[model samples]
Target: MIQKRFGSADTTGRKLDVIGEYLSMYQKALGNTNFETLYIDGFAGSGEVPLAEHTDNLFDEDVRTVIAGSADRALNVDPPFARYIFIDKRRKCIDALKAKFKDSPNAERVNYSIGDANEHIQKICRAEQWRSQRGVILLDPFGSQVRWETIEAVAATKALDLWYLFPAGLGVFRQISNDGTVDQTHEASITRIYGTDAWKTAFFEPSKQTELFGEPVTKEKVVTPESAALFMIERLKRVFEGGVMDEMIPLGKHAYPSYYLLFAWGNASPKAKALANRLSKAAVKATDRKHGRIV
Candidate 1:
């Protein structure tokens, strides 16, 4: 059974719980030797969140429960050799993570980095210690914090399985369509993640119609969260080799916010495919639950 972390239930917490459970199960089914370089949480948050679902009251938060669960599973495996590398931009998040995992037996094996995840990737990848191991990177950026070049660089490593949290609905598409300023930095960020100029075409093309908030949309349409997500998933598929793409929806009645799109790649083995399928199904179930459907 999976251990529950967050006390008060909310959309984000439930979603994290589902992800953690599925990931742990996937690791177990794949067995101990399946991966060498273990987990990577790019947008590693505090192991909890402070805001309650309906209230504005502030409280302590720590969102690293998923990482904690993954670590526990890794340590229980036979070899006990897997390592976790967590990266976060905020020092507060780093401190919170440290406090949350203070008692973890695998804490010593964990590597925590404070700074831009992209800037540190080369250093982490080139380090002699991780050269021989296979990797699974969980990129859960808050918005569009991750760059496309970083994704490409990580892909170049040729031994990575990426589980990305794309900002399709929440960030890129919405901003580009709604905001007039069209900042170079934002454009560059989108290009980096998409790894191509195709997005420009999508934005400018007259015939392309995208759906936003369940409404039929055109090039001039405001970027809906769904379309942005779909756009990212499609582009990511083009760049990454031998990976399955799937979206994760939340479960239960509190599901109005957003969903996750998981990109699984590396080795292209049967195990990878199977894990992708499992995760996809799990995502749907979680989404259903989030919407208050009986699943």
Candidate 2:
């Protein structure tokens, strides 16, 4: 098999570690339940992500290790999920995953698909019998690939917990221009991501200074990159019935926040919500402590 190199940072390992931790806890909590638990990896990449370029900052003592992708971590969970679904847009990625897991003991229990992650996710949510199925989905897209409706679909299931790697610095923060001169394309993408145009008011404000012609310049941005993640959390709470985590585990090099790892539960039941919340919080905290962060 040809090894494909994937870009990663110190926070990449941290993000994967958090996913691994949550899956283990998720399995343990529901392992005895009558409900069939599932693990779904949206935007599932190759089985492993090689970290040759950014190994120095990785938390693990084995600096030369290849980081296990989310799908790999899910399969490693003890008394594994009853079913697994791995979806990726790239044919090569799905092929690689299929090849990597073909000989596994649980290969029969896993399903692989090559297509849009959002489409596959929505189909699953709409088709599933949520009452008898409990699941966790990892949405770690390359950029702003996840649409708002897709998120709504997940929440509608009322049985799946979501770990979303929102592109805070890399996608949302980049789309928003400081001078407020966002192009039509960016405006549309941002609106699609936030599910509303309210972000225009939340992240920007009217500038006191005006152009030479006395016409007001585009609204000046009122928020910084660090605060963007917080804004997203607020938007997520509106759609996720089980609510969202108050804070996100920022994924990037030290002090340079890129991706925001957000957790939201779909289950509306008090007991389910509390368990998911507790486990998710512990997972993030454990990952941070392991990385020597002062969380």
Candidate 3:
């Protein structure tokens, strides 16, 4: 089977490693609990990813290595999740996953969906069965594919923990010019992702020079990529009753800001919230110590 290829092997590997750590912790903590644990991968790629690693081969430039992706990691968690749902918009990816797990002993426990992840995840979150179920949903979108409404749906579940990789640089900061010019389409997209227009004022400020002409006072963007990511975490804290992790891991290649992994617990119980934060934070810190911070 052909494995899916992705760039920034170091960064992507670090993300999956952190997630893998938390998955193990999550299952061990709640494995014997009454809650029916689940694992949902919103952007589940082919079961494994092919990462290019440096090689000393004189003929070949690099060696391609296969590593378990999130779906595979979740499946292998020590006290496995009760159910697994892997969603991908690309039919080929879903097909690949189905083929990979078609003959597994617990294959029946894994559900594969081929369509928009946002729509499918929102539907799952809104289902009534969530009251008796608890799970972790990984929203590792390629860009800003995860809409704000979908996040709200997950928040409402009050059972599923969230591991959202917000596209801070590629999606948000890149769209907002230094002069604070946002086109119609970009404005709508940003608003949809943020669930409000407040980001405009939150990330931008009136230019002192423009006050003189008052009529079309130009706005100057005041947010750096790092600050923009922090803003997103703060916005998330407002919706998640369980609470949001304060230290979001910034992930990018070559020390550039690209994505920020934010963790939030949906369960309102204080103990659950605290445990969730503790495990997720440790996982992030572990990955950072192993790979060094991505700036």
Candidate 4:
């Protein structure tokens, strides 16, 4: 499939490894539940990457060459999923993905599309293939590309599970300032990502900042980067029927949490909670080993 230099942020590999691990675990844990499984990768990049060649290995297995994308990894797992849906915005990525699977015997089971992941995902929710299946959707966007409405749609399905690579530290901490005033566009992005403007309540105090002359000032803001991340997680936990698990923080080579990895599922789903807990535990340990020291 499409191959890129293994040179993105350092935590990129950690994120992929954790996602791959969860996919394998979920398949093994629920494969015999008599339900069809559908795997979705939002922002599925080119099918191949230089994880081994350019960065330290983070996967459970070691490889020195190019590595399989999440889409391919899921396909290789035991108790195969019933269907695979991969969506990427880049046409080249889609073309490469198709080329990678073109000769495969199970190619017919995989579907690739070039478009906004959120839009296509809503379509998946409406498609007959996803109607009765257990959906596992992974969203690994570059920045604030995933919106809360997307998560809402998946949760509305009442049958979908979600894994989000939320750029809490990168997106929220950067845009939400120490002062009450937020960056214009970032305010919208963060509000949409959190699915509510109420998050500002967590960051800013009710008391307003006043001008030197005693005029009405904007609200005062006070919160740490870590707290900002928690706010996002907590807000999302409320949206999913299956609560969002404690976050798995992946460290950037720069020695900080690059993003918060979280999973959420439908309401009143004990199975969803159990599976999410398992995945959360595994991701926590994996992130510790692979990227914790850098932090």
Which prediction has the highest lDDT against the true structure? 3
Clashes of each: 25, 0, 0, 4
Stretches off by above 4 angstroms in model 1 are 1-10, 34-37, 55-81, 126-132, 178-181, 205-219, 248-259, 279-295
lDDT of 3 by residue, 51-89 (tens): 877778789988888888888888888888899999999
- Candidate 2 lDDT tens digits, 80-155: 9999999998898888888888988888889998999989999999998888999999999878889988989998
Error of 4 at 7 (Å): 6.3
State residue 281's C-alpha deviation in candidate 4, in Å: 2.2
Task: Arrange candidates, best lDDT first.
Answer: 3, 2, 4, 1
Of the pair 1 and 4, which is ahead by lDDT? Answer: 4
Off by over 4 Å in 2: 1-9, 54-65, 212-218
Which pairs clash in model 3?
none
Please list the residue runs of candidate 3 whose C-alpha ends up more than 4 Å from where it truly belongs after superposition.
1-5, 52-62, 208-217, 293-295
In candidate 2, which residue pairs clash?
none
Q: Which candidate do you rate higher for TM-score, 1 or 2?
A: 2
